[model samples]
Target: MSMIEVHHLPPGTRAGRARAWEELYATQVERATVTLGESETGPTLSSGTLGPIRLVRIEMDSGLLQRTAEEIGHVAEPAYSFLLQIAGQASFSHYGQDCVLGPGDMSLCNNAVPYSYTAHGPVELLLIRAGIGTIREHLPSPEQFCGRHLRAAEGLAEHAVGLSQSVFFQLAADLPEAVHNRVARNLLDALATAFAIGFDDLISSSAVLTGRHARVRLFIEENLRNPDLSPGFIATRLKVSSRYLRMIFAAGNETASAYVLRRRLEECARQMADPACAHLTITDIAFGWGFNSAPHFARSFRERFGEAPRVYRREKLAALATGGGALSAGATESV
Candidate 1:
């Protein structure tokens, strides 16, 4: 939650600055070959962790950085970096695509693959790194967006960059952890929207359907606690026909109602297994996720999870307490 201020490595000589810059990139950013065009003025970096995302602000002299295929194998963890060009221009090459981004432009860079960027001049950039798994859930075919310049002065990209700038410059370090997490989530949502809009024409129709299904799933998850949540409501809210909505969900081989019921039951089982919900009764937990009838909820939960609600909860919780359960983390549904 605390902002990490990485002071410019004591400015003295070009050699010292170059070494400092290398060290900073190796530690703060991903390890890559950094060629400094003007070694006298080393790059300045300020970084921090925002929940599951990491943010870094860098101002550096012109340079070229490369992450080669050989280097990628050594990467301990793979992530996607959303780079916003705030000043100067840069050219990026990745996935056989090349792009040039000027001020108020952005691009998504995949760290899992080889890529390179060369700055035309002194540059200031905001780089956000998040787990690929976390971002892939929201944006299908993330690879298609990589190395493509997105205009930050228009549409969702503008809003996303603006919000990120506000957090970088205006937000105080003392803000609560929850507030920082919320900001990070909002930023991701904006970026997802930007990518979705920017690549609309480039993606195939099936991809568009997948994207729509993802959005519908997100809507359902957000409104899961509402008893009145239904496919019709979702279609109206998303500005699509109920019939079209069913078609989208059908791509995943499930009806909208079935998906909703499955998700509700899964949510109930999740809460029942969570220690934080220990004080809540089985019926309370079931109703909390919009299950109207206790018996029906119990039957559905058992059918999905292979045990009675109370029994499953007790066994799962006990296993967790003893560190013996194969309780897998839930993955976001993908179409």
Candidate 2:
């Protein structure tokens, strides 16, 4: 099948246009219910895929598109959809957060969760969807940014918005798969930088303890591959006492050690579910993500995920081979 396609309803009744768009969305994106006003015009969509990344541009009159919990369950894989407001305005609600986005603004949606978008008037939007593994590969704890409005005029976010617009414009062009893949990767990197910088700025301006917590979290995320990553080592590197480090996590109602272990296990789970890591053994994934003991890793994996590592990997692979694999609910939940 071709990697790109455009969809526009023929001159017809508003009802006809709504039905057409509903079907188009289900095929190109996930299953969504599109509703149009009686006097509104039809919607137009142009979509393209680059590796595991999907790019879409949509324009329409006042309307709404929603994906409910049931609809979310039907999705084949967990992903994150980044939305950029190209023109007009739209209201988005997800994860107990709501925001109205104007031209140049952006927002994120976790596809595994229920969400809705309402276009106030004539609106144009550019959206990019990437798999969970691909997203985690770039951003640390992406869920924190989901549902928050990202102003395009901000520091790195401005650059990210520009990059996203350029990428969307390039999606329809005839290009080699390798070129598309490279562009997609670069886009992810730019977005990750924007998110990281914004998050850092937010925490840096907070109280001293909060700032230290943020720094420690970033440090752990960056060093998850190091088998020696531990609370004591992190405290040493940050020039803080071990007790103080523990106190920071305690203030957040979690232990520093527990936080580190959870992050490492989550990273391991992500890599195990990714097809690119198929060549790596389960033990290798555990060790690479800071688990020093195979037996301990196995016990923890089962305790947290409710299954043995080998069994989990095998099931994921089998489901993937049949094109029906769905991301586990535990792995896809917002961090």
Tell me which residue pairs clash in candidate 1.
none
For model 1, how does the per-residue alpha-carbon lDDT over 230-251 read when each residue is reduced to its tens digit?
8888898999998999898786
State in Å the error of residue 159, model 2: 1.8
Tens digit per residue, CA lDDT, model 2, 1-335: 45568888777777788788888888888887777844555688889888768888898887788775458658888889888889999988764457999998888787766567889989999888898888989875666667778877765887887898777666655666668878898998888787677667544544567656756765665566678888889989999999999888776578888887776676677557655467777887788777888899989988989998877876776654445554443432111
Candidate 1 global CA lDDT score: 0.75
Once fitted onto the true fold, the runs of candidate 2 whose alpha carbons sit more than 4 angstroms away are: 1-3, 38-40, 201-335
RMSD of each: 17.8, 14.2
List the lowest-lDDT window of 10 residues for candidate 2: 326-335
User: For every model shown, what is its TM-score relative to the native structure?
Assistant: 0.59, 0.60
Global lDDT of each candidate: 0.75, 0.76
Q: Give per-candidate clash totals.
A: 0, 0
Off by over 4 Å in 1: 12-16, 171-173, 208-335
